[model samples]
Target: MSFSSIAAAARPRYGLSCALAALCLSYSLHANANTPPKIGGAPVTSVTAAHYYSFQPWASDTDGDKLTFSVSNKPLWASFDSSTGRLSGTPIPPANVGTFTNIVISVSDGTYRASLSAFSVTVRSLVNSPPLISGTPATTAAVSQPYSFQPAATDPNGLRIVFGISNKPAWLSFDSTTGRLYGTPGATNAGAYPNILISAYDGYFKATLPSFAISVTVTQASNGT
Candidate 1:
């Protein structure tokens, strides 16, 4: 072959080799590209002092890589679980009862990382308050009739309230969580139940309502003249 012809042939071969090399390089880069780890969850913003609190974030890596968890500006009383991404502990009064701000939680998969939005936690001291019991119970019920009474109760401190009765009747049933007293009064259950005092209790205090009575009697129609 002539010199110019040989040169032109070599030029096409070189160009083809360069194109194949570039295609291989692009495929290698795309196959090895790393997708970042993803982390997210809603963290508790407010907690009562002397009460247990916990927050756990969900984390995952699309590339199926092992993840490592990290936290920044963590509270002194709280502890972190790097493997599970759990933040938990009890805050004490007078010391940890304040706002902890700009807390960051992140997860890394060696090549890339992701993080949840920065958050803050406010710890407030526990202030106890007595629960209030309201509503009236019926004083009389007829035989073979359904009788129901539920005392409305609430706590000022937003704590849970449990109910109790000092002199509950044998024919009635009481629910502690909702303060409901209910039952059907049969003919044999017709009688006078007295001195029934309903009480509400929070974790730190208790409140009681005035004592009441329930009287079950046979209907006048049943004892027709």
Candidate 2:
């Protein structure tokens, strides 16, 4: 073959090979652009009540595309900052004190999206303060007479208070829910009762008041002359 004819034959094949390589590169780039972003982060297990809490999640796209972050099923006391991929807020007491599960943190690269559900957050209850018993109970009672009194108490956490009594006399009845002590003493029950104890509870903690004594006197019956 002549030199011109050989060069002409090789030119077509070289051009075809270049075209095939360009097509393959174009397809690779397109595929990478469609790849989803990978989401990654750890969950906070515990946070103090009424305190600020914050956590940042991470995401990346293989194609270097811009990513956006979001969250779902977040607690009402907290919020997710989509622009910064941060979860932050202050949690209230009691109502916010519990384990929260399956908070979905998601990331998207416009065309594709990814999610991480491994994060669970816990808002711990505030330290409980002992309930306080207020005032002293009356130390005297009359036989066959009705008596009723409620021991005053307070809880620093605003929790409901329960009342209890120890070494109670048979004539006296105690109410745990309302903290009331009430009952009628029989005529034969006239006597001195000592070391009667009263206590208060605020669900998680308790406090007791000092001991006191009660004297029940007999009622004199009227006789017609």
- Candidate maximizing TM-score: 1
What digit string (tens of lDDT, one per residue) describes model 2 on residues 91-194? 87888988888788888889887988766788987987788887678888887778776778888867778898999998888999877888888877788989
Per-residue alpha-carbon lDDT of candidate 1 for residues 1-225, written as tens digits (9 for 90 to 100): 899999998998999999999999999999999999889899999999867889999998888999999999999999999998899998877788999999999999988879889999999988766888899889998877788989888887776788988889888899988889999887888889999988999766789889999988998754563
TM-score for every candidate vs. truth? 0.64, 0.48
Candidate 2: segments with Cα more than 4 A from true spot: 1-101, 104-120, 221-225
- List runs of model 1 lying over 4 Å from the truth: 1-15, 38-45, 49-104, 108-111, 116-120, 222-225
For each candidate, what is the lDDT? 0.89, 0.82
Highest lDDT model number: 1
RMSD of each: 5.4, 11.9
Model 2 Cα RMSD, 1 decimal? 11.9
Candidate 1, run of 10 with poorest lDDT = 216-225
